[model samples]
Target: MGALFFVKHKPTCREIDIVKLTIYTDYSLRVLLYLASKPDATATITEITEYYNISRNHLVKVVHNLGIHEFIITSRGKNGGIRLARPAEDILLSDVVRKTEPDMDLLECFNPKTDNCVISPTCRLKSMLYEGRSAFMAVLEKNTLADAAGPITQAKSGEAVYVNISRLKR
Candidate 1:
């Protein structure tokens, strides 16, 4: 009854399918897309946090992970902050999703030692899950950060923020 967003039906014990993205994944995608749209804007953490009005605390880990994955480069100096390692077109959404959702194993029964799956030896779940993940990425691969930023580029609902794609239309 005290849950923040999720509310259990209490009558049905349906396995709560976690088909949603995590904040870590969410922020990574948002930040990367935002940065990619900025076009030569090497924005700082403070500036980004302010633009999106997101918590700097949560974004810290996301930014750090992005740097480690080589999707983005970070530096400290007067002209240093964070910037894309490669061009926006070169960086695929699938790549970002893959790096961000590293632990997206659908089932744990595939493990050898503590295999919870009773049919571990012949279970097809692992293969199926792999296919599903692949298919998901296949869809995402078709679009780039520039594509996902469709509505974001149009109609000013508030103050001017960095990377407003709406303003870039020719």
Candidate 2:
């Protein structure tokens, strides 16, 4: 009789799938972090671009989207700059991630209109991916912008706090 040994195989590249955050989302988060880090001062796109060494064209789009979403306020003309619409503690990480992420689909089956998977009708993978995505988002929900950006200074009694008035649109 001959002894048998077990053999293990590593997953091939074809078997592995990778997901990455878009540059838009990356820039959005970086902008948010920069603004949050300087709650008392406004930041300009040029300043942010220089600080991060990112492209002005791309940062402009990110800043515009942030303003449109009410995540950040923008002021034009002299002394014009950007600032967070709300306090860092008031911004939810999950909300930011959801708003910034271009797509949440983890697999082909996740989107019915574009799903071409043969197992679409009876795929356990979809359920597993949903579970995973939910778990991932749940973690973000537990945290706030302040958690990543650090605590904001508390205003003392009879002290004024900096507020971005441009973000007060109804």
Give TM per candidate: 0.69, 0.78
For model 2, what is the error of residue 112's alpha carbon versus the real structure, in angstroms, after optimal superposition?
0.9
Question: Residues 1-170, candidate 1, lDDT per residue (tens digit)?
Answer: 00111112111112334445556777887788777767577888888888778999989899999999998899998888998888777777777777876454545543344455556568665677558756766877897766665433333686434445523535
* lDDT scores of the candidates, listed in order: 0.67, 0.72
Residue 98 Cα positional deviation in candidate 1, in Å, after optimal superposition: 1.5
lDDT of 2 by residue, 1-170 (tens): 01111112221222425545556777787788888777889989999999879999999998998998999999999999999999988888778767877667766567677677776678676787679778877877987777766433458785544442212344
Candidate 2 at 154: error in angstroms? 10
Q: Which candidate number maximizes TM-score?
A: 2
Q: In candidate 1, residue 151 scores what lDDT? A: 34
Q: Could you tell me which 10 consecutive residues in candidate 1 have the lowest summed lDDT?
A: 1-10
Output the number of the lDDT-best candidate: 2
The reply for model 2, stretches above 4 Å from the true place, is: 1-16, 151-170
